[model samples]
Target: MTNASLTDAQLARSIALEAGALLQAIRARGDASGKALGDIGDREANTLIVARLREARPDDFILSEEALDDQARCAASRVWIVDPLDGTREYAEGIDDWAVHIGLAIDGRPRIGSVAVPARGAVHTTDDVHLPLPAAANPPRMVVSRSRAPEIAKTVALAMGTPMIAMGSAGAKAMAVVDGRAEIYLHDGGQYEWDNCAPAAVALASGLHASRIDGSPLVYNCADPLLPDLLICRPELAETVLAAIARAR
Candidate 1:
C-alpha cells in the first residue's frame, strides 16, 4: 500500500471509530442476557469492522481476534491486527469500559494504532496527535481486570505503593493511562496479539512505556500470535514497575 493513499494513523482512527459505532449499536439493543450480548455484539462488530477494512484497504491483510487464523498474515510485512470488541464481559454487563481496538503492525511491531471507548466517549490514537501527559508525580494507579484480577497484580500494586483499580477490557485499561485516568496497566494472564496490539501501539505512540515484564518490547503479526503478558505504565514509573514484577516473579 502506498503511504499517500491512507496513512497508518488515519487508517487506525477510521477503523476504531467505525467499530466503536457498531459496538454502541449492539449495546443500545439491550440484549444482555445469557451471554447474548457478547455473542451477537462481538460477532457483528468483528464482521463489520473486517468487511470495512477489506473494502478500505484491499491490498493489506488482516489478523483479527474473531476471524479464523490466517497464516497468510505471517508473510505480509504490514498487516492490520484488530480486536473488534476488547471487553465482552463488560459489554454484556452493561459497563462502559469496553473498547474497539485497531492496530497496524509494520515489520512485526505495532507502529500505528487507535482505540475507541464508546461508553467514555473517548477516542485515542498513536499518531502525531498530542494528548497532554498526566502529572508525573501523581500516585501510581494500577488497572486490572474486573472479572479476573490476578493475585500477582494485586501483589504488585501493593509493592508499588499504588491502589488497584478494577476495570474491564485490556484495551480500555491501557487507554486509562493515555487519558490520565490511571497510571499503570499490567496483566500476566494469557492474551492474544489482537488484544494488545492496538492499545500497545497507541500507548507507545503517546510516549508511554508498554512491554513485557522483563522490559522487552511487544511484537505483533507473529505465527504463534498468543501474548501472555503486558506491562504499561507511565515512563517515570517504568523502572519501579518492572522491578516489582521482577521481584514477584
Candidate 2:
C-alpha cells in the first residue's frame, strides 16, 4: 500500500495483524520447539515484517527486535519499531499470551501502534478500545509472568497494595493494564525493544501510562536495542508505581 493510501495508524495495525496471522499459523502447526523454535521463528518473522514495512514505507527507517540494529535509524526522524511476535516463548509453549506488536516511533516517541493477540482473538488499536477489568471492584490488578516472577516484582506489588496475577508474555502483561485485567505490569531484567514497543504504544494511545520504573518516558530506536525494564500502569497509580520501584531497588 502507498504511504498516501495508508495512514501511520492504519499501517501499524495492518502490520501487526499480518504478523499476528502468521504467528497463528505457526502456532497451529505446533512445530515451534527448543532453541530451534526461537531461532527459526525469530528469523522468519523479522525478515517478513521488515520487508513488508520497508516496501510499504520506503522512506521511513525501520528498527526491529529480531533484525540487525541499523545506526541510521537513530538519525531518522520517523521509524517503525516492531516485534513480529512479542512472546515467542509463550507461543512455542502453546500459551496464549503472545502477540504481534507494531509501533511507529516518530521523533523517538511511539505516536501510534497496534497489537494483535490471535490466541485471544483480540486486536487493540490506537482508538476506540477499552481495557478489560477483573470481576473485583478495586484499584486494579497487577499481572506478572508465571515463569519469571521475581522477588523485586512481588515486592513492588506488595508496596503498591494491589493484587498480583501471574501471566505469560510481555505483551499480555501490558494488555492486562490496557484491557483492565490488571492495573500495573512492571518487569526488570532482560527484555528487548521488540518485546514492549507495540504494547507500550497501544497502552499510551489508549490513555494508559507505560514507561520505565522511574516513570520516565520510553524512547525507541536506540543503539542498544535491548530494553531491559518497563512499567505499564494506569494513570491514577503512576506515583505509587514509581514509589514501588524505588522501594524495590
Candidate 3:
C-alpha cells in the first residue's frame, strides 16, 4: 500500500494495527515469556512503528519509548509520539491490558492518534464514529493502576465517593473513559508524552475532557517529554474531577 495517499489519522491507525498484530504474533509463538517476550515485543514493534512513520512522513519527527529521542523533534511542529508497548509488565505476565499508542501532535497538541489494544481486538482512533457514552455512574467510576494506585487518585476517589477499577497501562485507563466503562482516569504518580498522547488524542476527540491534573492543556513534542500526569473524564465531570484533585493535593 502507498502510505503517502493516507491521511494522518489513517496512517496512524494502520501503523498501530500492524504493530499490534506483530506483537500478538510474537506472544502467540510462546517461545518466550516475561521479560523475554516483552523485550521482543518492544523492539520489533518499535522498529515497525518508527520505520512506517518515517517512511510515510519523513519530515515529521518521532518520539518513541524504545528509540533514542531525537532532540531535534522539539523544533518540529508535527511530531509522532509513540509507546510501542504500553503495560509491558501486564504484557509480560500474559495480560490483555497492554496497548500500542500512535499519536501525532500538531503545534504541541495531540491532533491525531490511534491506540491498538490488540488483545482486546480494538483499535481506538480519532476517526472513530463518536457514540454517546453510557451514563456515567452517579459518583463516577475511576480507573487506577493495578499495583500502585496513586495516592492522589485514591484521595480524589474517596473525596468524590467514586468506585475504583484496577487496570494496567495508561492507554487502557484513559480509554476506559472513552469506552464508558469508567467516567474518570486520574493519574498522578508519573507518565511521559508517549504514555498518554494517543490516549489523550482519542479521549479528547471522543468528547471526553483530557488535560493535566491541574487542568492545563496537555502539550507534547517537548524537548524533555516528561509529562508526568494527566486527567481524562467526561466533559461534565471535568470540573468536578479537577476540583476533587485540587482538594486532594
What TM-score does prediction 2 earn?
Answer: 0.90
Cα-lDDT of candidate 1:
0.86
Model 3 clash pairs are: none
The lDDT for every candidate, in the order shown, is: 0.86, 0.79, 0.93
Which model, 1 or 3, shows the larger lDDT?
3
Once model 2 is optimally superposed onto the true structure by TM-score, how far is the C-alpha of residue 119 displaced, in angstroms? 1.1
Task: Name model 3 segments beyond 4 Å from true.
Answer: none
Residues 1-249, candidate 2, lDDT per residue (tens digit)? 463478878877777777777767765676657566756666777787887788788899887777777898888988888887777777777788887787888887878888888789888877644555345327567898888886778898787677789898788888777877688888888887777887888888877778988788898878787888898887877887788789779
What are the per-residue Cα lDDT tens digits for candidate 3 across 1-249?
688779999999999999999999999998999899999999999999999998999999999999998898888999999999999999999999999999999999999999989999988999999988888888799999998999999899998899999999998888888998999998885699999999999998999999999999999998888999989999999998899888878
In candidate 1, where is summed lDDT lowest over 10 consecutive residues?
Answer: 1-10
Candidate 1 C-alpha error for residue 197, in Å: 0.3
Clashing residue pairs, backbone N/CA/C < 3 A, model 2: 131-178, 131-179, 132-179, 132-180, 133-180, 141-183
Cα error, residue 116 of model 1, in Å, equals 0.6
Model 1 clash pairs are: none
Best by TM-score: 3
Clashes in candidate 1: how many? 0
lDDT for each residue of candidate 1 in 18-49, tens digit (9 for 90 to 100): 77887788778776654887888789988988
State TM-scores per candidate: 0.94, 0.90, 0.98
| Candidate 3 or 2, higher lDDT | 3
TM-score of 1: 0.94
- List residue ranges in candidate 2 displaced over 4 A: 1-4, 30-32, 129-139
